[model samples]
Target: MAKYKTLIFILEGSLLNEKVAEQNALRQTLKLTGREYGPTERIQYKSLQEKTKLLGFDERIKLTLQEFFKNDWISAKGAFDNQLQKQDQLNKDVLPFLDEVKNKVNLILLTKEKKDVASYRMQNTELINYFSAVYFKDDFACKFPNKKVLTTILQQQNLTPATCLVIGTNLVDEIQGAENANLDSLWLAPKKVKMPISPRPTLHLNKLSDLLFYLELS
Candidate 1:
């Protein structure tokens, strides 16, 4: 039998691929603002975005564009929309694993993306069918690495720490959040992804298909 009754999957980088930058948002911002910005300015803009993450991804991006680029709602909104559709590629290997374990495990989507964006991507990829429930970033006031979000989910599901597991691509905050919640976690780190020295999760897997072993699916 599988060890956990509930499996919570982080949606952004965990299932879908990373965002591919087609048009430079930075340049777009500068052009829209009619300002000259060099590498240093670009670096500063990105740093600010990372720092103000508590405001949420889309919100932060929108604010950054408004503050730096000024009065270009159309361009700023376009840049945001581009990112929503960027990582549409699926980890094909996960399909078969989901097929085998779908009936046995309670699937849940715990994502950092906004609800509308998450729904759009999952629906486009036809991945929404796998999850019984989805909790988005907007759903929680406190973000990941804070135990409150996971604690709330656990309470809602009436599930204990021992019976739940989080499978995510991030080794830093994701794993730390799971541990903080006292729940087991599985880190999905591909060879191409450079991981920092961080707290390890219950399992470190290179491929999503590796979950089949834990599922005991043949």
Candidate 2:
């Protein structure tokens, strides 16, 4: 067994290289919809969520939409599920690297995905081999930044926070969740978002290419 019991990796969606992702999503969505909605006109994942409160859509459909963005789906049943494109290049970083390191890691994917939608997306992308487990909010009683959910994972995995590292793009939620769980944290700010000086990540990185180097893992 390695010194670390398991290397639990959490990937934040939207994009690792966020700008290209936004552009790609907008371009693809517009092309698919055949509507000239400017990229800026589309609301963000959070905003579209709030939109459900006003516009009347079926509750089930709205819930699916909310889950769709985080999971990075093109569409469900050929209907546009989300106007978001995952950065194609981010996958390039993982496939080659994960293939090499997977034996040394017990990979688990934690995301805000609802239901098993992300699992479906991962299968479509053929990326399911990269993870041992795929967890979504519906499986747990709570969501991120809520210690109860982290506690659930900890208990289920028989893991201590000291032996784990939480990796993600968002600082306030992801990193803070790790901190609250007493785990080491990695903030992947590939877009160069300004991280505050206080409560900084144990490791801060600009690219997934630099991940192995920063972690000092084989």
lDDT per model, in order? Answer: 0.72, 0.57
TM-scores for all predictions: 0.69, 0.66
Candidate 1 ranges with C-alpha deviation above 4 Å: 19-81, 191-197, 216-218
Question: What value does the lDDT take at residue 125 in candidate 1?
Answer: 74
TM-score of 1: 0.69
Report the Cα lDDT for residue 47, model 1: 76
Candidate 1 backbone clash number? 0
After the best TM-score superposition of candidate 1, give how far the Cα of residue 58 lies from its true spot, in angstroms. Answer: 10
Candidate 2 deviant stretches above 4 angstroms: 1-5, 14-22, 27-81, 85-90, 214-218
Q: Which candidate leads in TM-score?
A: 1
- What would the per-residue lDDT of candidate 2 be over residues 25-112, giving only the tens digit for each residue? 5456556656454544455544554444222223423453345443533353134435332333344466666776676767777866
Best by lDDT: 1
